[model samples]
Target: MKQPTTDISSQQAEQLLQPINQFLQCRTPASWIEQAKQPQSLPILLKDHMVCELKAAQSAMLLIRRYAVDEDSGNALLQWLKPYEDFTYRLKGNWRDLADHNKLNKRMVPKSTKPYSQELIDKMVLLIKEELHHFYQVLEIAAELGVSYDRITSSRYARGLFTHVRTYEPAALVDKLICGAYIEARSCERFAAIAPHLAPNLGQFYFSLLRSEARHYQDYLSLAQQISDTDINPRVQFFAEAERALIESPDSDFKFHSGAPV
Candidate 1:
C-alpha cells in the first residue's frame, strides 16, 4: 500500500505540539497554561479524555465484529455495545452508568473452537482496555470541572469512511480495515499536528497517544493483509483516496477527528 507522505517539517511539528501542551495546561483553570505547571492537572485533562477512549474501544469492537468473530460473536458484540451507543446517541441509558459498568476483558469466544486465530482478539482486548481507562480518566476530569456528562452530536468523520464499506462479506471486512487504518493514521497525525496549540499537559497527553494510534494503524493493516490472499495495494489506494477526500474536504463541524478547520 502507498504510504502517505510525511513531509511535515520539524518546525511545524513543534508549532503543533505547543498548542496541545497549552490546552493540557489550561484544562484545569481558564488560564492554567500561564500559571504554574503541576501534576494536579492530569486528572482534569484525563476527565475529558474519556470520550476518546470510548470511541477507540467502539472502533476496535466494530473491527472484531465485522472481521474476526463469527455470527454469534457479532451479535454479542452488538449487545455489548448497545448501552454505550445508546448513551452516545442519546437513545437511552444514563451516562453515569458508564462509570460503573464492568470493564471489557477476556471476551467470550465461540464454542466451536474453529480455526480462527486469536491475534485479533488479543490486540482488540488490549485496545479496549486502554480506551476504557482513558474513558475513566476523562470522567475524572469532567467531575473535577463540574461538567455534567451530556451527550453531544457525533461528527461525520466515522460515517464518511464507513459509508464506503462494501456490502459484501470478506470484501466488506477488507474495506473496513483499510478505513480503520486510515482513521488511526489520521488520528496519530492530528495528535502531532494539534499538540503545539495545547498547553504542556495537553501536549504530553496527545503525544502519549501517538504510540498506540500508530500501532493501531499497523494492526488494522495487518488484519487486512491476513484476510486477503490477493495484493491489497489497490484497495488500500482506493481507501487512501477516500480518506484524503474526507480529510481535505470542507467540514463545517470542528471535531477532534473532523477535517481541516472550516
Candidate 2:
C-alpha cells in the first residue's frame, strides 16, 4: 500500500528523501539547480512538468495495455487519457473540464499474465491514477502561476535510458521497469533538491509528491525483479551506471530530468 502525502518539515523531507538520494547516482547538478530556480524559469518548469505528468500517465497506461489488459480495459484506459491528450495535442479542451475525465470509467480487467504478473497491473494502475491526478494538480498550479500549457520537446534522459533495453521478451519488460525505477528515483531527488527554492506553495506541493514517486520507484524495482527469470543484480547495475551518466553528464537541453546544462 502507498502512504498519503501530508505536510512535511525540512527534517522530514530529508528523512523521506534519504533512500531516493542514495538510489540515484548523483544529485541534481548545481548548474541545473541554479537554472531551475531563476525567475524566468517557472513557466518553463511548470510547462514541462505538466507535460511530464501527462507523459508519465501515458507511459503507465501503455505498459498495462500492451502487457496486461484486455481490449476493453485498454480502450478504457485510452479514454481516461483522451481529454488530457486533446488539451495538450489538439488544444481542443479546457483544463477545468479535465477533472471530470480523470478516472477509469469501467473496471480494468487483466488478460493472461504470461510474461508479467498481476502485480504489474496492480502497481501500474495505481500509478496511472496518481500520475493523472498530479497532471491535474500541475494544471491548477500552472493556471495560478499564469503559466499556459504548451508542448515542449522531450529531453534525452528517457530515450537515452531506453536505447539500452534488450529487445527480447521479459528482458525488455524488465529493462523498462528498471528504467522506470531510475526515472522515478531521479524525480524524487530533483523535487527534493529544488523544492526549497520554489515558491512556498509550490515547494510544498513538490514535497508532497515525494512520497508517491518514491513508492513508484520501489514498485518499478519490485516489478522488474518479479519479471526477471535470472538474477537482476547485474542488469540493475547496468542501468544504474547508464542512469548515472545521464544525470551527471552535460547536455544542451534542460528538462526536469535533463543532465547538467552544457
Minimal lDDT window, size 10, model 1: 23-32
Query: Residue 86 in candidate 2 has what lDDT?
Result: 91
- Residue 199, model 1: lDDT of 64
lDDT (Cα, tens digit) per residue for candidate 2, span 139-160: 8888877788877888898899
lDDT of 1 by residue, 49-72 (tens): 455567778888876765567777
Return the TM-score for each candidate structure: 0.70, 0.95
lDDT of model 1 at residue 87? 64
- Among all windows of 10 consecutive residues in model 2, the one with the lowest summed lDDT is 1-10
The global C-alpha lDDT for each of the candidates, from Candidate 1 onward, is 0.61, 0.85
Q: Please identify model 2 stretches exceeding 4 Å from their true place.
A: 1-5, 113-116
